[model samples]
Target: MSEMMTRENLTGLYVITDTTRFQRAALVESVSEAIAGGARVVQYRDKSDDVARRREEAAALAELCRRHGRSFIVNDDVALAIEVGADGVHLGRDDAPLTETRARFAAEGLDAIIGVSCYADRLRAERAAAEGADYLAFGAMFPSPTKPHAPGAPAEVLGWARERLGRPVCGIGGITATNVRDLMAHRPDMIAVISEVFAAPDIRAAAEALCHAMAADNTESIQTTEDPETS
Candidate 1:
């Protein structure tokens, strides 16, 4: 196993790729721009059945993330993640069981950073935490263009998970720079975005704006929580 990705490494902007938005070359270029603009984590989320192409793209992304020293995760494909040596894998409800995936990683001598999608279910988040998920993701924080039908999760869930689950929490779906401050009120460790960054005219600029927004919010949150008298 390479360096294990701890919960501490799960912070900041997390960008998810949309195959519908970009082809292979464009995908690589756009992701490079995102990383350059301070995306700490990148997830390859192709749902197509093209095994060879998926593998190729995932391998390319894994290498790109490795070069940049950013965490790379594969969505819902343990085999592909293992093949590409990804730092982690993200599991949705329909995906493989977390324990089985962890066993597979152990068998392969990889300390996979597995993240579980809890949607709006607190019980499900608790279960995932108990089952050893490295992080918990909740959303459709807003109406997601990419997954419009995805279940809507309230921003409060992000705070709840961070307090109770003892793992990093990610807010995903439809989060953009404009409304990110609203989500930031819940203080999510990371925000997972798709179309908001990748669909923009300038991917790097969009990513940078989001990162800057998040940082500003975090600064405000810390200051608000601190005791001025103590200072």
Candidate 2:
């Protein structure tokens, strides 16, 4: 086994699974295609409270990502992530405080891969890094159907983060291959896509396009560099 949650795992195309966009039965299949297409990271985001199904799906996706050598993240639910053996968890500001979450995961003997959503706030990003978050996410940089009212981050958020922090900066929301290059100008370590990747007729092709865009910034080639865990 190789390392997981390393800074090296932060770059490239990130695929977020949207339950609304994919039927339950097809979710795993869709995610598999995404990995095959070149998604470096996979986030299992399900808003529904179907615990049984969520666990089942998350577990399946977790195994799939492991098999493909991709990092798997669970959004907003550390328990579910732990249960599924996911590589990490992504938390919104409204979710459990990072310190608490970290302590809880620590109690379970997990160093947990955690990413914090700072929305449009640079200060919050700074705080999250201080709190020991692995990466900082800012956006709805563009209007997003998934989160229509999500606050907008200024175009310079990524640039500012690069100047201010050494950790990875992930640019998300309404991100697509076509428009991703604009955000890429600031050199985001990751580009997170939902509809652009899952809603496309060909999930693999869509992911490939975004993967290509991610690599344009001299990101790691969309090839073998397994193990999200890092030292």
Candidate 3:
């Protein structure tokens, strides 16, 4: 793990900021609430083409997450991640290659976490791991407001990934307190959320709920594994 994903155990709520819902100023407040509520991971995910605005918002968010001791990531923007001194970058199919990103991080002397979005393709995830990605994210587990047209991934993938990759597997897309159980059944290392955390009326409450769910799920998994009869 390139020091980018500094967490030894990358399990729990991963909050993503939505530009549409949280303005630049409001982004800090909402993200702070998420941090207070126990969100350990945050991603600055803005799809806008406005480089200046993105730089400004991402810088602020990176600083905010740093203050909370959380991993701050830039979505699909290597340049911005480097500029903001982010923990890492999350890349989609359209983004630069994972190998390139890894090499770039090294060249820049930055400890960076390189996360790849596998969507629903297990083969792609396998390839990503082989290529040195720190973590794999798969999602659209349910109907998602963030990516309404995204294809849904089976929860089983999370379990398979955890076993196969031997690294953190993040489940994303429409994950909330209500539907998170399905994903949790697989014991994913993390679950990424956009609107649920940033757009909620009470950001702290929403994040807390998700955090509690993940902790409970992880604890259950540990207990089950350690049980003599189950073993």
- Best of the candidates, lDDT: 1
Candidate 3 weakest lDDT stretch, 10 residues: 222-231
For all candidates in order, the CA lDDT equals 0.89, 0.83, 0.83
Cα RMSD to the true fold for all candidates: 5.0, 6.8, 4.6
Q: By lDDT, is 1 or 3 better?
A: 1
Tens digits of lDDT, candidate 1, 1-231: 136455578999999997888868888999999999999999999989999889989999998988888899999999899998899899999998999999999999888899999999888998999999999999999999988898898887787778777899999988999999988877899999999899999999999999999988875442133233421
Cα error, residue 121 of model 2, in Å, equals 0.3
Model 1 off-target regions past 4 Å?
1-5, 222-231
By summed lDDT, the worst window of 10 consecutive residues in model 2 runs over: 222-231
Q: Flag clash pairs in model 1.
A: none
List clashing residue pairs in candidate 2.
3-229, 4-228, 4-229, 4-230, 5-228, 5-229
For model 1, where is the 10-residue window of minimal lDDT?
222-231
lDDT tens readout by residue for model 2, 92-210? 97899999999978888887788999888867888998899988888988999888988888657776776677788898999888878777767778888899988899999999988
Q: After superposition, how far is residue 202 of candidate 3 from its true place, in Å?
A: 0.6
